[model samples]
Target chain A: MPTTPAPGTVAPAVHLLAGALRRALLEEGGGFRLARVLPGREDSCAGLAAVRVLGADALAPFVVKGLALPAQDAALIRAAVRAHPAPQEPERQVLLWGIRDAALVRGLAVSGVDATGWEGLAPAGSTAHLLRLPWVAMAAELVRVAGAAPPFAEEAVHAQLARSHLDISRGLVRALLRRDLPSAACLTRWLAPAGEQLTTPALDYLEIAGADDPRVSLDTAIARRLTTGTSP
Target chain B: MTRANTPISPQGDHDDAADRSRNVETETDAAAARLAHQVGERALAWLECMRGSFALTAETPDDHVEGQALKSLAELALAAGMVRREAIAGPQCADTAGRLLDFGWRQVGRGDLLYRLQARTPAATYPMEIYAPFAAAGYRHERMDRLAAHLLGLRASRVIEHVPNRRLAVVAAAATIGVTVPDDVAAMIGQTWLGGTPEPWMLDAGNAYGVTHTVFHLTDWGGRPEGLPQRLQDYLHQWLPVWAEVFCETRLWDLLLEMLIVGTCLQRPLFFPAVWERVAAAQRADGMMPNGLTTPPADPHAAWRNHHHPTIVAVVAGTLTLSRAISHATTAGGEA
Candidate 1:
């Protein structure tokens, strides 16, 4: 899920920038500019922070369109990569590895400059249904690049997804019942990509529920695309 | 672009996980039986202590004995009769059932009130509904039965439209009273909210209760499993656990208890020991059920007024699930 400004503080510029990048990815002709994406002298830290939060999705349109990665955009990613330490938390760690790997595939980071292999970090196990929900971020990142960066197609994750379809569906039901839309939307987006083939009544609920929160709107938009195979 | 080629997790595994969910293994059955009995016993101990709450007197400590208490008393008598008939709850529970039932019968004025009510409103269903449990316990009033038979003959009684589960209750309640005049139960079942087996993900608290009570009437409060259709049984097996988890999170303790009781009556006897433990834990030391009240209301009369139904529900859930657990064990032993 894209970040929401934490309540009670002024929403950071990076949060708005990340949302702009997400908006570009979703809206047709929303214009992807190399200059805007490159780390700049002012608020460049915030710019890279925005990309870090949005993860690989920040690079999606460039990667998908086969456009050359600008040298400055590469530097922007490198700066973001250098600034943040690898997280100790499992979900954050998964996010860290996914962002690094997305850069590697797109030629933004050379070997040894940034760590790449995300497979070892993919959440896999009996507790996946409960613990791995955050893995939706991994899927969300991967969805932006579609076929170019294959996170779900990786062997271990695919096997886990096979076993977890029911678990995923069950989690989706609970999330909806609890009125936890962000979770519900995340689970909905991840369902079919994780190999679950079923009607997502939860997505249908989100569509009609009229939630105006931008984060939920983005997640639900992506969810609608994933489940229905419509344009994002 | 690493074009994706790894096959999606096979449809075979998905179906297999579903298959596993439906089958009840022998060991699980034995453990569940023990657990179900424990939950019911603790709940019954509490209800017996608070048996005065199941009163029909015009007034109690603070409030009038109205619809809620009246319904609670009938359900108490119903649960007591079921336990006494099943005799699976052991001597102490059965003895508690016996005393509480005597208390319940006295509350109804030993059927005089029921007879008078039926006479007053021959078109009404509550009098027959309340009287059936008493008759099942051999507390007969010949006049009441005659009144019910006459009511059953009326073209009006047969056609009164109740929402599907209520319709099933009326039909099942008739059977409990030993009247053979039957309505089209299968037709009624077809009309229930659950009969069509609507979308499981859309289930809300109100519809959830509708689903639970429909199952209750189908199984005669868990006395018969064959009465549940294979289609509906399979439907519940697949979805009931998820529904139970949702309700538990919502803290609908009584609804969760009802769903657990429904689980015991399935042809395969679905068991979730964790859920049973949580539900049993929710019962207070003195046998008062929190029902769904997270905190007791400040007014004493309001607290007593709101208290009666879920506690009675606990008794039925306990009796029905414990009885099912025993039968499941018997069947398992026979197979072994």
Candidate 2:
């Protein structure tokens, strides 16, 4: 489990990534200069470039580690990606990189693995139906990045549950990274049955939706209580 | 018309920060009562002005008044009639409403003339505008039903020709009284070809008039059960604040009223009360609200005629929003 930092504590990874990003972009001065802080980190230049493409807001959750972004911000990133054209390799790496591991980004880029339904899937279609597709097919690239085998072989799962359940998978990625048990549990219960065919350990996390878990975030707490594998 | 303006706070006498501390039930009830009172007062004052004599001369070759000007009077009648029925503006307004509605109906050949008169309007000009409120007010005249059917046909013709946005007024009128639009018209209105284009006339996400009419039609004039699709709802949620700000700055009361309807449809009374405050502030002592801050014709009668449209719209907007807000607040309070 990633250590949950106190509020306002900037993670070292965030600072490092941000520092590398600053060095890459020679913008008009606004804040701290990255080149001055961390002189040489050429290895993560591609990651920095990717971060710039995907934007710091999208990559913030991974960089900050345990911090769960507000659902609205998470939604904005998805919307922004859908609105724009598909990015190239390094940029795709930065954008698709959900975890804190550099190796995962490399593996995702080289694997050239087609997320099951992504190829012919038009991003500009009805968002509701797009969200309804099987989670594995929808997040196939992320699954490969996370080293989880794809969920299905033939049939696709339609997300019959609320639209917010579609968002849970993204939230689950952050929770899995954080290893926040309560949060993961709540997300799993809500997402698992909806995308029943999905094959990931995160699916079996814990069904504690609505549990009075002060340790976890408010969203996760509410989600846990709302779904316990009993209620729809 | 105007681009950008500083944000105008909606915090009339109600401080939102303090509102947070107070119980939800109490706040909602208080807000409802206050709004209802404000709207009721304004509606009465507006009724007093509209109660005078209305012109009924047909806008043919001889009449000085353009058919467009007279058509607008009927639209005002429909709005005033709506307030009269709401029991907000006193019962005396009912006779005035009937007079205006009947006069407007008569001017448009009382649904008897088959000749497609282009009278001042760009496309076909019919009594589609007045038919909506007429039907809504429980007037069972066959002419209204006929006009509604004519509108549906016009909508069908508009769709088949790939015309955009022009059919909005007819479609809006139809929805005002719960007429189910044909599948073709629905398809035409639903999909936008210029999704990515910056063009202002794109029906889905451009031009204030098209957007407002689309919203009005889809939401069934703020009477739809759930209101617009999630995507459109999201779009309105983002741009309405900006649109409201601009319209309010330009002093475009009619468009601003439409914005209030959109706000009501989205169930965000909190975001819109500021507009109501602005409208209420703009009202003159004798109940005349100018169409905009734009200068009116120097002739007193011309100014009166010009001022009447916004005043009628303002009254309707206030009555509709306030009544809806009270209902919403009441429901919310009960739930709390």
lDDT of 1 by residue, B1-336 (tens): 111321111112244643454354555655666666776677677667667666656635322336566677888888788789889888898899899889888887788877887787788798889888888888988889888888886779788977888878887778877777658888888888789887677788788889888987788777787788999998898778788876876667778878987897788877766676777778666555676756866543465556556666777777776677667668867875
User: For all the candidates, what are their Cα RMSDs to the real structure?
Assistant: 7.2, 17.6
CAPRI-style grade of the A/B interface in model 2: incorrect
Task: Give the per-residue lDDT digits (tens) of candidate 1, residues A66-102.
Answer: 3445566656665665665345455544543543444
List DockQ for all candidates. 0.16, 0.02
**For residue B4, what is the lDDT in candidate 2?**
19
Report clash pairs, candidate 2. A209-A224, A209-A225, A210-A224, A210-A225
- Of candidate 2 chain B, the 10-residue stretch with the lowest lDDT total is B2-11
TM-score of chain B of 1: 0.86
What stretches of model 2 exceed 4 Å from their correct place? A1-232, B1-44, B47-65, B88-125, B140-165, B172-181, B192-206, B267-271, B295-300
TM-score of chain B of each: 0.86, 0.71
Scored by DockQ, the top model is 1
